[model samples]
Target: MRGNFITLEGGEGAGKSTQAGLLAAWLREQGTEVVETREPGGTPGADAIRALLLEDDVPLTATAEAHLFAAARADHVENLIRPALAEGKWVICDRFIDSTLAYQGAAGKMGVDTVRAINASAIGDTWPDLTLLLRTDGDTGTRRAIARDGAEIDRFTNREFAFHRAVAEAFDEFAATEPDRFAVIDGRNDIETVAQEIRSIVTERLK
Candidate 1:
C-alpha cells in the first residue's frame, strides 16, 4: 500500500512546524511509519538551496526566487520524499508546492499560473493527498513570528505587513478553490486544541 502524503501550509508563524511534528508523532503511535520533513531542505542539495533562498543577503528577482523554490522542490521530491513514500512511509511535510503558489504566484509578481507551470515538471504526480491550511490573521502571525525569531528574521519573514496579508489572502483563496485537497484550520487557538483538531481531521481522512 502506498503511504499517505500530508502537507502543512500557512503564512509565517502559523505553527505549521509544530503541527507537522505533532501529526507525525500521532501517526507513528498509530503504527504508521512517518517521515517528518520540511520543504526546500529535505535533502543535502535541497538544504543548500534552502539556505540560499532564506538568507537575508541573497538578492533574487521574483521570477528567479520562484524558480529556485521549484528547483529545490524537484530535488527534494526526487531524492527523499518519493523513496520514503514508496516504502509506505507517511510523509508529513511542513510546506510544499502550495507555498510557492501562494507566496510567489499569488502574492508575488509572478502570478499563480506562471508559478504552477514552473512547478509542473518538478512535482508531477507527487502532490499532497491532503494539505492542512492553517489560517491566522497576518498581524497575529507576524507577532508570533517576531517573538520566535527576534532579530534573526529571514528574508521572507522581513517582508512588509501588506505583503504578508496578501500571502494570507492568497492561501485562503487557494483553499477555497481546492476544498477536496485542503482542510482549513483556525490557528489562533491554543496549541493543544489546534493539534486535536488536526488529529481528528487526519484520523477521519486516513480511514
Candidate 2:
C-alpha cells in the first residue's frame, strides 16, 4: 500500500516546520516510516532553487516567481517526495502547491487558476493526502515570524501586512473549497497545544 502524503500549510510563523517535525516523530513512534521535508526544497536541486527564491535579492515578476516555484516543486516531487512514497514511507512536507496558490496566485494577483495550471505540469497528480492548514492572524503571525527570524527574515515574511492578510484569506478559501483534504487548525495556541490537536486530527482522520 502507498503511504500517506501529508502537507502542512499556513501564513508565516504558523509553526508549520515545528509541527511537521513533531508529527514525523510521533508517526515514527508508531512504527511508521516517515520522511519530513519542506518546500521550495527537499532535494538538492530544489534547495538551490529555494535559495534563489527566498534568499536572493533579485526582483522577479510574479509570473517568473510562479514558474520558479513550479520548477522547484517539480524537482522536489520527482526526486524526493515520489521516491519516498513509492517505498511506503509517510511523507510530511512543510509546504506544497497550495503555498503557490496562496502567495503567487491569490496574493500576487496571478490568479489561482493560472498558477494551478502551471503547477499541474510540474506535479502531475501527486497531491497531498492530507493538508493541515494552520490558522493565525496576520499581525500575530508577522510578529512571530519577525521574532523567529530576527534580522534574517525571508522575502515572503518581509512583505507588507496586507499581503500577508491576503495570503491568510487565500488559505481559508482553499480550506473551504477542499474541506475533505484540509484540516483547519488554530495556530494561536501554544506549540504543544497545537501539536496535540494535530495529533488528534491525524489519528482520527488517517487511521
Q: Please, what are the lDDT tens digits per residue for candidate 1 over residues 1-207?
A: 788999999998999999999888888888889999998789998999999999988888889889999999999999988889999899999999999998888878688999999999988899999999999988789878988944458888898988889999999999999998999999998999999999999888874
RMSD of each: 1.1, 1.0
| Residues 1-207 of candidate 2: C-alpha lDDT, one tens digit per residue | 788999999999899999999999999999999999999999999999999898647788779989999999999999988889899999999999999999999999999999999999789989999999999987789889898744468789889999999999999999999999999999999999999999999999996
User: Could you tell me how far off, in angstroms, the CA of residue 31 lies in candidate 2 after the best superposition?
Assistant: 0.3
In model 2, how large is the Cα lDDT of residue 152?
61
Write down the lDDT of every candidate, Cα atoms only: 0.91, 0.93
Candidate 2 residue 114 Cα shift, in angstroms, is 0.2
Measured by TM-score, how close is model 2 to the native structure? 0.97
Runs of candidate 1 with Cα error greater than 4 angstroms are 149-151
